[model samples]
Target: MILTVTLNTALDITYRTAALTPHATNRVAEVTERPGGKGINVARVLAALGHESVVTGFVGGRTGDALRELLAAEGPGGKAAHAAVSDSPVTDALVPIAGTTRRTIAVVDETTGDTTQLNEPGPTVTPAEWAAFLTSYEGLAARADAVALCGSLPPGVHVGAYAELVRLARAAGRPVLLDTSGEPLRRGIAARPDLVKPNADELAQLTGSREPLRATRDARRRGGRAVVASLGAAGLLAATPDGSWRAAPPMAVRGNPTGAGDSAVAGLLSGLVERLPWPERLARAVALSAATVLAPAAGEFDREAYADLLPRVAVTEQSSQPEQESHATRQHR
Candidate 1:
């Protein structure tokens, strides 16, 4: 099973309205709530794609209870939904804590296709709570095929949390993927994870360069075995030991982009577990990311869209000297 770690789990609530205006109240036309946080989102996508994935991290209080129930609920947007259709289901191995889990709100403007988000800082995790999590993670990591260390550290937790998790997962001989931002990402990269998935902005913050190719190289230099940088609508640009390549969607897609990155992580993880070639893996990652943007909800990918884009995603092998030439000068098949 693939293991995912989310230090700051959240109850994600989405609201839709006709339009959004500053300083004006708007009536909600639709509402949807589900379990979220980067790792949980990744686990949901992996489960949908028929991959066995176990989610681990901190969760507690009444909000945490709701998140767990949502994970196991039978109808829709839950584990039973995936279990009803597929053999692989998402497992919740979340640890309980003293503080209540946080909630994040996304206000979607249907008319303009824009989203305004309000994310709460998650519950503080004490040192004892952290110790308990480490114990749980050690057991879970031992039995997993691969592990993804994801999301932000909760309050009171040290910034080096992901770094330490990377070390532990690596010591267990498991292929580990680190997905996070800020100081957690900065420190985690130094632990030399199997892969690090950072979006363009996050990559820039880490490497001091907005240039995708340059920043990806710089990130790898810091310690990732490989770096896959998400370039939003431009798709993904990866710098790996095998070679560098850029994958782009066939056409521009428009929709809510909340969990697109998580879907990409799912695609990459799935490919790694299946031992697909780097180009093929990148193609799947790009297709999944595009499909998620086209999906109505976060973490859901339209299978038809993915299939349509799979072969159409433009994959170009990049040159060895990225610093010498711009990506626009690269050739494509």
Candidate 2:
């Protein structure tokens, strides 16, 4: 089974309104809540795609209890279970803590199709709780076909948490993917994960370059076995040992972009375990990302949209000659 780790799991709450105006009260038309955080979102997508996925992370308090209830309701004999019994299920293996889990708010403007997100800092994890998590993670990693270490570190958790997890996953001989930002991302990449997925802004922050190609190559040099940078509506730019390629959707998709990256991660991980080619994997990632945008809530995608976009995605090989020349010129100067 694919294993996903979310250190700072959250209850994702979305508010939909006719329009949003500054300094004015807006009338909400709809509200939706779901279990979220990067890894949990990935697990949901993977499970939908017919892969057995286990989620292991930190969860506690009332909010945590609600998240687990919602997650469980998606399984067999639950209110909103999967339509088909053949679909793989998402098993929760989350460790408990004393602190309350966090909640994230996303306000969607139906008129402009824009999302304003308000996120609360997660609960502080005590040393004892952190230790408990490590123990749980070790056992889960051993049995996972692949592992994903994702999202932010909660307050009081060590900055090198993802780095440590990456090492453990590697030692267990499991292919691992790392998706995070800031210092955690810096250290995690150094652990040399099988793959790293960073958005354009995060990539630029890590490499000090706005150019996608340059930033992606630099990220790989820092230690990722492969780097796939998400370019928002432009699709994905992948730099791997075997080769490089750019995958783009047939057209831009308009909707809530939240959890789009997680869907892409799901696509990539699923492809890896299925032993699909890089191009095919890129195509899948691009299609899934676009489809997620079309979905109403986070951590979910429109299945019909995904099927329509899959075959239309364009995957083109990128040349390294220009990057080589650019590096040589910089050295000469």
Best by TM-score: 2
Report the C-alpha lDDT of model 2 over 1-333, residue by residue, as the tens digit. Answer: 999999999998888989988799999898877788999989988988999999988999999999998888776456654332225788999999999999998888888888888998999999999999999999999999999988999999999999999999999999999999999999999999999999999999898889899889889999999999999999999999989999999998887787899999999999999999999999999999999998766557888999999999999999988579768866998
Per-model TM-score, in order, reads: 0.93, 0.95
Q: After superposition, how far is residue 119 of candidate 1 from its true place, in Å?
A: 0.7
- How does model 1 score by TM-score? 0.93
Counting clashing residue pairs in each candidate, in order, gives: 0, 0
lDDT for each candidate structure:
0.89, 0.91
